[model samples]
Target: MSETDTDATATGTPDQRLHPWSWLFVLLQQLRQFIVPLLVLMFAGRGDHDAWPYAEYAEYAPLAGVLALVVVSVLQYFTYRYRIGAEGISIRSGLLQRNLREIPFTRIHNVGVHQSLLHRLFGVAEVRLESAGGNKPEGQMRVLGLQQALALEQLVRHHGSGAATTTGIAERPDGAAPAGQAEGRTLLSMPLGEVVRMGLVSNRGMLVVAAAAGLVAQASPERMMGNWLEQQVRGAAGYAEQLHLGWLGMASAALVLVAVAMAAIRLLSVALALSQYYGFRLIQTQGRLVVERGLFARLRTSVAPRRIQAWYQQETLLHRWFGRRALRIDTATGGGENDPRKLRELAPIATPAACEALFVHLLPGVQWPPAAWQGVPRRCWWRLFASSVPWTVLLVAVLWWHLGPWSLLAALWLPWSAYAAWQQAGRLGYVVDARLLAVRGGWWSRWWRMAELDKVQALQLQRSPLDRLLGTASLWLDTAGAGPLSPPLRIRFLPHAEARALHARLGRVLAARRMRW
Candidate 1:
């Protein structure tokens, strides 16, 4: 039996409502945004009588808000309907003011299906269709039956890929391959041990801790955090005095505490990695790359190789120790580059050999880890050091005004800053060929950003007043879907004439070739 025959019926061109359980999912989604405030209201007056003057109203306000949310969800679920056609999907939604939206298959760059724990329980999933350069998703289906969602996704994917479809409906029998599992060759898969290693190599737990600390700081408007920290310090000092600890003992104790904290952080990181990357798989099928992952919530997303604009690769000291590396790509999908739904990570954690293999597979004819890197001019180091002088002077001036003699210590920053600048300039390098352009730079954590010459969207040559004096210029290559986290493909401190020549060459090449997404 066809899966679509279960709950959703495929007519020639009929409007379809979302799953019956959509309202509950919508309500849950809406509730998440107000969870913190609802929590605050729930405990507003319990601690102190004077905490809130309107405690009586606060007690019932959350309940009232929840009821309103439920009503809104119900209205939205009932009002929203979509019609599938051969070329595109038409969505009609909204409660107060009706909205009719038409999104063509060609315009949709990404199709994402997300299934959380709750969604899995009811055998439904959320679907998002993203277009290029949008502030919000083009089409969002809050909840749909898993099979129906898969069918919709398949239909969109087929139409987007320029495949000929006689009907808008997609039907799959029980023995047939599901939507995303269309006979793909597995490229990468992570087991539990590898995921654990990835967690250990990553700073996700530290980021979580920092975020929690920020939340605590934001919540404690009246210096509660400060008071708590002060109390802890006092308690530690008293204990040290009782032990008659000397400087060495105090240093050892601090080291121990730091180690303990790091251990805890690593444990938290492991748990988070397991939850996020459990059963992670990367597959290549039908000329598209597919990624599927998540523990409690599953995510499936795919992108065409031609749709990828730029590629990113990185390896930190920890990554080296773990014998792993990360690969990410910038695709033409919109909504937001930072959106978690974006399939950015091709290989979140892979061995050096595996990473190299991916480079060979994904980028045919392009060099992996360019054999020869053209370094910036030797004078670039002096230029970088000179740029730091103003900041160093500013720091010294502020410190001298505050501490007089102790400000001498701040003066030590200049030499260190110069050394750091020299190290950075020495490491900066780039490679450009007829087919590809790659740039890499870093002293400790190294990264490489590269893209095909045809993928270049814009080329810019910049020269500051200082650059003019030093006879240097910078070249920047812009591509579609560049994210905030990935550094731009820019090469700085090139000789002025070389920069101009490269810019002119790339501009001519880009002008001659037809660019894909």
Candidate 2:
């Protein structure tokens, strides 16, 4: 059959089918989702065969299920077809349901092209198109020629920028760029050293260890894993006793062991970071930003600046020591679930100056990290300290039960807590201008959240009984695509009147401007 058969005249392009191996990819995807359940079914069937009348036939159940899925995948591969049009793409699928979806280029907020090791071996890629307010990808092409996939991504991007009026793009089917086409300027690239630095500054290794331990403890019966850990610790203690080491020597040995473990965790983090971001690069091309990374499974994702609803910058104590900051953006691409496909990281690790330049370039009129910050009320410090009092009291109570007089030593924490609260409160501040509003908070781990006035979807002024008593209020700004854990776009501990004035001013600006995303 002709590859470009003009069967879809309305789209001004030929209806195209996925790669011949698309069925295999689809089957693999299905298997990945059900592999654990399939394993459990097979084992249970084998172990309990003697308990049921048709027990012997149970062994074949998983095989039968696999065969059925294979048939479904083949049918889906043959039935699915798509056409690229001037302004949008059309997808048709399903045999009985007969589903047809048309997604406009303008509405497509993020385009993700991924290539797994298997796909790379077959010279194919998977393409996912996401639009605003979607629970899943608007379109997912499981297997396409790598060249064709990139061309489709380029087509959508160009159309979004009004650079295309037809289905064609300046790219060859074999993956050659059009002659004289300007290659995008690279905004940031991570070499192995930087990746290692990022790994050193992150706690990914510790998180992995904690998650693995939790999983082990949950999976084991009767606290088997915990018992094993306790036995190992006792064995180590016995070995130390056999060595006849003094208390000082034992302490030194323990310190050395702890240091070694810490080193190993840091190394693990570096390895993980390298695997995920070996060839990371961010590029700016034709009014859009593209990021490509990964060592094993490569990803190339692109998004328009206009689609970004909010900006986030974070600098932990480690980040400050390493002179790096992480920048992320909230985009209109919504998958309802925590979508890994979303383009969140603009820069995973970069110097503060580099981040500033990127902000200036992407958001032409807005200043970053706001030059001047207005501090929160001093009473907010007292409020913060007071909130910690109950927790401190609880700790002291627990300690006193364990060691009567030692509980008084825990009271020393109150003074440290008060100092920390004072420092954090001093760092809590907000800045605003005609085009941007930003809030900065945190003491040891600093962060800034900012958004354009036009992107602010709602404004809220909150006053609690305690806040009222302290003559303080909070002003919160809401934006599209902001996650529950995202740093609140809020300025807390403002004087009541100041919060009202700021809220009213922001409300007026939002009312006058139309939200772009």
RMSD of each: 5.3, 3.6
Q: Tell me how far the alpha carbon of residue 459 in candidate 1 is from the true structure, in angstroms, after superposition.
A: 1.1
TM-score of 1: 0.86
Whole-model lDDT per candidate: 0.83, 0.84
Model 2 lDDT tens row, 141-253 = 99988878887887777777778645463225554334464668999999888899999998889999999988888888977987898998999889999999979888999
Candidate 1: residue 290 Cα off by (Å): 1.5
Q: Which parts of model 2 have CA positions greater than 4 angstroms off? A: 1-9, 44-57, 169-180, 336-338, 399-411, 514-517
Error of 2 at 414 (Å): 2.6
Query: Least accurate stretch of 10 residues (summed lDDT) in model 2?
Result: 1-10
Clashes of 1: 0
TM-score of 2: 0.92
Q: Choose the strongest candidate by lDDT.
A: 2
What is the Cα-based lDDT of residue 263 in candidate 1? 98
Q: Candidate 1, after superposition: displacement of residue 79 in Å?
A: 2.9
